[model samples]
Target: MRPNARFTDVQPIGLDAVAAAAGTDPDVLRLENLDTDVPPPPAAVAATTQALASGEGNSWLPLTGLPVLCEAVAGELRSRTGLDYDPSRQVVITSGGTSAVMPVLLATTEPGETVALTDPTYAGLLQRVRLSGARPHFLPLRVEGGHWRLDRDALTQVTTAAALLLMSPSMPSGVLLDRDDWAAVAETCARTGAYLIYDAAMERLVYDGHPRINPCQVEGLAERTITIGSVSKEYRMIGWRIGWIAGPVDLMDRIRMAVIYNTTVSSGFAQLGAAAALTDPSGSGVDEAAAEYQRRHDTVIDQLAGLPVVRAAGGWSCLVNATALGLTAPELSSRLLRYGRVAATPMTAWGGTIAPDYVRLVYSREPVERLSDLRYRFDTALTSG
Candidate 1:
């Protein structure tokens, strides 16, 4: 039997193709990216090595998760979010954050139901919602005071009997939802009985001295809001593919069932490594990476400020309005690779009705020293064109 082909319509990530076309080498800086340059913490490394040596991690963990890791995650949540979450009940460790969401969508929405998101949001969620046989409803975010804000009333009007998936410190723009915004969204979800799927993927990479807030902390939202996150960003363990879904036990039970077919279980040794990151995250690799990202963010911002075409905020990416150079985002992106030798992702692929003129330049992957090269080449391209 042929598998569903809905995925074919979903384009592969532009960054990978762009990087390939740009011909990345050790000497060239790669800024169009996510994840970190640093490795996972030593504790995780040591524990994984120990687990492998003892042959302890060879067995598959339970569908729900390894009990110890689940408990550790629970403790981490209480410490970080100040919300008392029962690990044994509320946590289901999936392969990663992406795995966590699929089951949540299946459990919460029926075919043809809507999954709403802010405009120009994360691309992955858009593809996931479509894959689940749901329509995507977009609420275009208006920029005010150099930050993106949701129109609550507009969102309520467009979406009913749907699930809203949102990322805090959102991708591309990196706008962290304020307390008031969170309250408004929570209230909307409650009134409408819409399941809230909070993707805390980019929340930890926050800048401008903002505190991270989980949507589950909203009053009466613990039962309704499902949070999907990973050890990728903060733990710098993107390769480990460890992530989770935390919410109501009953809801998580359904997610656990859907997880049975998708790789069945994550790597046992990797889970051990992930547990160490969760339990002893402070001295872990996150601090150094966070500092490096902060510096890179600053460097990218400074470099883009010199460019007539690029503007950015929050995350380690700059969205350049490239239409003035007489090219669509993809065309400009192609040109930047062939001519300027800079790789960037066009914003059009991210879904919604974002301007086709804009391209997202990921600054995180490039080292601080190499940033000047990308800037010089990129700016010169704009000038010469």
Candidate 2:
């Protein structure tokens, strides 16, 4: 191991293991990953197909990304944040949202520097911070009033951080950050001089009339924020592997260098599809998909109503309190997979104190029809195992 490496505390999220164990068992519901059965925009698919057939943009050139895709990303950011981004100067396409994250961390922080992240945040992100040689400082998300919330007191803790990774409709917990949360975030960042790396993978994937304040919308955060977005969630284009980073021109050069060196750009052909997905309003299907995901989220809550599952205000997964069952999350995960036919992932080192006490049930992957049997499965898993 390299002396500078910092991934010793990082544990696998258990999705791959659970998924591999699930194998060809069609009966096993695949809730272990962030996926959707919903199709991508037809225009995106068509564009990708055309790009592949034409063999256009098959070179290692254009290290940033396709012009159209970058412009589309800038436009999207502008519409949501009301902050204009110069496509050429302030944007760089990435392999995916996850890929974009590490580069931002690398660009913004030095080894042993602190990077604030939410406890119960994506394990991938926590591990990425570790991989980049940064200390992961978690802002605990307290379960309050049937929803997940960041601890206001904990926001003051991150004032020493070099970067703060934030996501609305935060993964696993599905907690949408409100106005107060954004305000607290602004205060923390302003005090710390930390870069706000906002993950927009599921920005628009909110539900039940909850509002998400774009980080850039917070006073002083527009220039302080670096937004990372991808087609994986909102546009339902996971396979395309295209993501973008948008920030101020001053900080963007280092981020762009990190982007180029990190993954050397997303697939050239896939960029065309992502551009199509971003530009084609009618076919993006974001709002419609959010509605369906909300239905699925509600269904999961209903199915596991009596269980200690936390309500997901928005996003893909629901956190089931494994501690209530007198078992660790990994133990519950195994039993659920074996007996319940559910492939929920155990929150091992995902982050925070409550992490290991819970397992995640990703609602986006399965349809409501398949999830109707969730209660029975949980019953069997709980009783038998």
C-alpha lDDT score of every prediction, in listed order: 0.73, 0.88
Candidate 1 wrongly placed segments (more than 4 Å): 1-9, 281-283, 306-315, 324-326
- Model 1 over residues 1-385: C-alpha lDDT tens digits? 6877656546565767767765745544565677556677888888889989998868776866788788878887776678887888788788888777778888889988988887777677777888888878886766665456666666658547678888876777565687777887877787788888988766666676777777777786667888887887777788888888787777777877777666588778888888998888465856567667777777766776644333333455656666656678887776776567676777776767763557776766677887766667776656664
Q: Which one wins on TM-score? A: 2
Deviation from native of the Cα of residue 351 in model 2, angstroms: 0.4
Pairs that clash in candidate 2: none
Which ten contiguous residues of candidate 1 have the minimum total lDDT? 306-315
Query: What would the C-alpha RMSD of candidate 1 be, to one decimal place?
Result: 2.5
lDDT of 1: 0.73
**After superposition, candidate 2 runs with Cα above 4 Å error:** 1-4
**Backbone Cα, N, C clashes tallied per candidate:** 1, 0
What's the true lDDT of residue 63 in model 2?
Answer: 96
RMSD of each: 2.5, 1.3
